[model samples]
Target: MRGIQLQLSQTQKVRLQKALEQLESLSSKVNSDASVTIADSIPVNHEDGVLKGHGTTDLNGEVVATLCGVVERVNKLVYVRSLRSRYKPEVGDIVIGRVVEVAQKRWRLDINYSQNAYLMLSAMNMPDGVQRRRTALDELNMRCIFEEMDVICAEVRGFQHDGLHLQARSQKYGKLSTGQLLTVPPYLVKRQKQHFHHLEQYGIDLIIGCNGFIWVGEHVEARDDMVEDQVNQTDPQVLIPNKDSVSFEEQEKNYTALETRKYICRAANAVRVLSSLGFIITLEIIKGVFELSLSSNLDIHDMLGSEFCVLVAEKEAERRSSNKKKR
Candidate 1:
């Protein structure tokens, strides 16, 4: 939706309108009563000792919603889960952020939270994967590891006295490259066990950040480079040179394939359409849209057209209706 601006014909507009109506109808049947807006009163029995949670306030004697969201009840506790709001971080959640500042012993990242998250140098593993004390040399070379405006992926390490702390002890967590980052509403992305996806067919990696940042990039196998270095050092006969010494032109030869780049654009467009339609974002659904576009023989750029948007709405409506019937 951020980059898509379509000019639709009259017929396209009518079809899109009808499809959206059907989608709204299907959604209403599932959660019509559960959804609430700001200042809406929540029904609760006072005799049971109700506890008000986030997004709810006591208005005289009634429990009124302080924000527009869905009312959630957990035993005696009640709260409103906001449908659209800034990201609220929790411990152990994976997030993608951009480096905003490089301070002493740490780098501050903009993680789409109330404040920028902090990534302490000591918390992350060194490039050599050797667990040693962070010396003064390490502090001086901090910019070499991460400079300003570099996009990185890390895990939330809980709040400290200064602010939110992050860690990147694993090989999977580090600076991301050769990728396009898309931002959506945090609520659209639901937390799951696996957020990192490697679509083998498309030859790309997808990272659905819990903080509403989605990254589509070329896949790099997760391996410890230090292991390879250790092997080189142990074997005197091995003539393999250091990867860091590779010439820039040699690295350029490994650029992403043209077909893979097309697939990336298609995958990115699928996410854009789904987010614009207010549908829940998931790995399976994204792949579905992508495959549908391919099956229809639509060009990568045409996926952003009004007709495709209507088709996606209709497909989602049918899917939801069938799922409801199955239940």
Candidate 2:
């Protein structure tokens, strides 16, 4: 759905069509009857008892899907996995979000979820790496840390009385900078062990947030609170600078390096291609495409071209096939 809006030659169109067909073929073989639309009755072994799970319901003793997507069964439980929907945060899932509002004691973030997520002041670790309680002065300085429209990375911390709550207790989970934020459909991002990656080769960082907000930019070292002894503790007064006094020189420091910026664009375009093809996103696949572009000497700007896209599709088909054979 991403680059297809561009003008295409007949040959390019044909290649894209073929690649899409191949993807459908592979998906169908995995579970021909597993894909279903809304209100479709799920096929089941009738002799045994069954339990309806999320995205499913019983209608006259028949199991039916309430959503449109693949059906999965685990033991006696059956459920539908929606292919397109707002982000549903699981506790502990890493999410990248934007500051939407600065409320009384918390910051509201738009995390692509059904509701805006809350980041209470009490849930955060002090910038000075102190373990003491957050004082009223700390609450007053919240805007200095994260203002409206600023991007942030955080962890899901279950629901509070008002809405979904997020936490940034660790160093890595905090404000994001020098990055390009891109949004893909939520279904394409699958949860895994790690969501943060530092691409040392390209000097870039990639955070594939579970809510589908991706950050591509120059890598920054995750701040270590344990190393506070090496440097003097930052004075609260100095830490909370007046917004009006912020200088141009300080802001210029946030600008990324030329080479790192190029890498960021290339990586972002790679993600665009994968999302357009509806492929499950993973580090291996993403890195494969990045290396493919570099090895072929393809210009960074040309990575999103129709010809390059077709090449990527063909390579992906071959790669998945090889993986299956190994398995």
Candidate 3:
């Protein structure tokens, strides 16, 4: 209901309701009473003292929710995980953010948090992937590494004197070129051990950034920009006509392969549809949706059609039911 704005026929509405009901039924088995709305009192009457946590408040000796989300009880601790909110970064969380500003010693990134995240030049690995100290020249040429508006992937490196800090200490965490950045409610993406996926069959890399910024693009090996001391990088074969480079025609020519691009579009559309339905996004589930599209022979553009939406909902209902039975 967060972003759903569909006008369905009576029949479609009934079917959707049935599917959603089935999903609710499956979810109800797991402490169904845990769902709460704002100001709702959580049903916890334990003798022991319960520590109030985020999204919770003490109201007249009762624990009440400050957000509309499901209540979770971890041992003696009780808290509500808000279904709608910006990303809450934890240490080691892999995130995708856009460079918003090049500050004196850091790059401010808009990573869907309440405040901008900082990526200090000193925290990042050197351009050559060497363990060298950051130099003043590096600070001067900060834009060269990450200009404003560039999509970057990094890890949360704990808070600092400057605030929420991010680090790109590995080859995998740096500038993200030639990709589609998809935003969804951060809760939809479950924290997993691995977020980066290389779909070899499609020749695309799927980076499920924990901050809800998903990236889909042509697959490329991670290599340091400084490591490329190749002759071509040092000198151009042809003379440039003007200071303005990367002409429109040349840029198009450098685009991902035709088939790979098609796959990227299809994957991105599949993700869009899933996010619209408020589905829990995981690598396996996303791949299942892609296979569903292929099996139904739905065109890339038709994945968003009303019929497809209904089908996806029904399919999800079935999948959840099957999982419940397995459990």
Candidate 4:
């Protein structure tokens, strides 16, 4: 276990050490014998026709691991699940990434993968919500839609000859604003059916990217651009908007409530604490930590202190113990 560097008193150090030791003991009970290092031979029954899977290769008829990870066996099939590795893009996985480059009709993003993922203009829905073919005008105005360093949420389309591809066809999939982007170990984030979460109480959106790029931002309602465009086109008053109306609209767009910002920070801090403890990042776990902080009346900054880290470790150890008992 890696200890976080912090200026701690003797009591705090002892408490943290105890909590971490308890956590480690619980983890050892589950994965002690299953863990493997590179070049380690994986014992298997050859009489059952054992098949070698990812991270394992046949070395003179012996199954040897190519990576350091935990060995997982699903019946006869076995593979090593790396503890820390780059994001492996799969079709239909949701990912949050920053726009690194805007080329001719496509955008390149660094998704913490071995290679940059590509988001082609033709693969995504346009701002107008039209299904027409992309034109030269659209290609020229690509930067206006997504410039350099703009954070975006997209779905993995698949791998092509060029590289990994992404698509943003839904309103929920687009540029993220007014939030903090946190990068954690990719293995900490597991794939789930629902990655996009709107905390109505906090008035924020939590996007858990499978790629370990999490976005915690102010929640924006999904709007149908096609319907909105039709309404504006038919309404003569909307076409010739008054100055007062335009100013109010701009103000509404630019303003972020102070309370919302506070919640965003609180939520972000919860993630930081969880990541620092090397806990699995999940929505339920995040909500539990956030609510615990609120109940304890801990300031956002104080959540990063040694006491909170110890508290989290103890709570996690207790939670896992109870869960194992139930099982």
Candidate 5:
């Protein structure tokens, strides 16, 4: 398939063209040698092929991909290229992100994208027996439920000017404290979206996002070394679910929960090891580093899980900086 670009309507085109022309004139004066270029930056498969913006010019006349989209007169700055696809969470998409900042009405998540996402108190499912609307007390109690670095499974509610908003309507979607956080480059993470699973052998659960933010955790308190033992066993007996005792739906849900837990835990372990090594890792990096195959013991979650530990690394760096200050 051909590479995709964002599409734009005629009105958007006219607006972009005018901006480009103005930017070109400005560029000529700003840097006599540098060229201000704008090509058809829309994606082929993008239904809304909007010309979002242009790129940036360095002092040495080299060009870089634009980080922010254009808003015409706001920046009057010549856009050099359209923003690269960063895979921020969208409405209705399931994602996993680490809680970074906790505020009055929302929690901030670094979703491995351009913008930090917001998880609002209003978006959360209220208590089972509560008859009234969520109160400030509810928010405070909920605040205690999540601390910095908690991994959460949530659905993107929508995007606002502030950031991407997330909702956790189910018990499955809240307070993921016992897990390792993984961070990968956004693009490769998107490619492995369909393969999320939890392996019974691995005793882990995995939550994957297009932005490369993965959350991994143990399904139960199992030893790390026991993982290999369980996965290597050929007992087809253990793999089969008990069909006689439960309804198909119940069985299916149980199997899914088990699988999700296993995948997340295994990925968390893998990510923890790699992130400790101080590499700016991606899903591709993990796949390459581990030398894994598609059909191997590792799953899509394992690859993206290699990018884990941004928060821990940041904290360590801060600690060192503080220690150095004391010296």
Candidate 6:
């Protein structure tokens, strides 16, 4: 209950416990009532307990229901209907992930499920805006876009025909180049609906997965004035402004955006990596991973390696492909 957010209050917990105890105490007396037959076995009708149901057994040797009032007949099925949650990944779902390994032309991601998900090089879009099939030149470094601890977001691309392939693709789907990653419980991740949808508010690129993996990184906000500052395509916005002359409002907004972006980015990356390790990716885990001298060691530049993380992710994808066949 401590781990679950939807836990009952202390008063409710005590009341529920008392109610269960009362039920247990009254159970025997109710069964022995005269109106009840107390048959060698509960009747089939009562067993299901559906119709003033009594605990009864059927030919299949299963209890269908638990009857409370009278044991009218024997040799009947009675039991409470059991239920279970049976959900699987879906397309278009935004997922937070870490590149666990890279092999060949793919990246493997731990999407907080039983199996690590895959992202293929062919699914990658080139920076030059050229739409060509991924080539040998696209050989993954396994650490470029998705490092061992990088967090990323992408759309669910549907599984392969073999039922083993888990893919995520789309331009909207890409690596979080800056931010923190945090890992909450899998249950919390499942209940979250707006995963990665509100990053613009905080200026962080956030990705989350049902498996409790999350990635956070910094993203520079689009600047209206900077739009006209694009002097060259290769090296846009060359004019440097004096740091002291910047207005308080602009500076405040930029600083706030930068700080929020870094905070979320780090949280997201830490969450994804933590999810992959099957542990709660806390600030402690992050410090340990980077071997930081101090908390301040948690800088974006140290952890956000775009190319390296990507290659690591690709390797993970290759590993997932291999495991799927064995399954």
TM-score of each: 0.88, 0.87, 0.87, 0.86, 0.45, 0.44
Which lDDT tens digits does candidate 6 get at residues 1-327?
122222345755565445434434444544554233223343343334533232443535433333333434333422322111223577766667777877667778777667777777676554444566654434532243344655556656778853333443345556664455555666444534555444444455445555555555565542212211221233323433443476878656655454675556455554444343233333334434333212436455534333223322333334345555586
How far does residue 35 in candidate 2 sit from its true spot (Å)?
A: 3.1
lDDT of 1 by residue, 89-174 (tens): 98989999999999999999998888999999999878787787887666766776788998999999999898899999999999
Q: Stretches of candidate 2 above 4 Å error?
A: 1-3, 37-41, 45-47, 54-61, 224-240, 243-255
List clash counts for every candidate, in order.
Answer: 0, 0, 0, 0, 34, 81
TM-score of 6: 0.44
Q: In model 1, which runs have C-alpha deviations exceeding 4 angstroms?
A: 1-5, 224-249
Which residue pairs in candidate 3 collide? none
In the range 173-275, model 4's lDDT, one tens digit per residue, is 8888889999988988999999999999999999999999999999988753321232224333333233234466768876999999999999999998898
Query: Candidate 4: deviation at residue 150, Å?
Result: 0.8
Off by over 4 Å in 4: 1-3, 37-41, 57-66, 74-77, 224-249
Clashes of 6: 81
Candidate 1 versus truth, CA RMSD in Å, comes to 4.3
Preferred candidate (lDDT higher): 3 or 5: 3
What is the lDDT of every predicted structure here?
A: 0.86, 0.83, 0.83, 0.86, 0.51, 0.47
User: Whole-model lDDT, candidate 3?
Assistant: 0.83
Q: Write the per-residue lDDT of candidate 2 for residues 11-106, one digit (tens) a residue.
A: 878877787777677768887778988889998876777778889888887888889889988998888988777788899999999999999889
Weakest lDDT window of 10 consecutive positions for candidate 5: 222-231
> Which candidate number maximizes TM-score?
1
TM-score of 3: 0.87
Question: Between candidates 5 and 6, which one is better according to lDDT?
Answer: 5
Indicate the worst ten consecutive residues by lDDT in candidate 2: 225-234
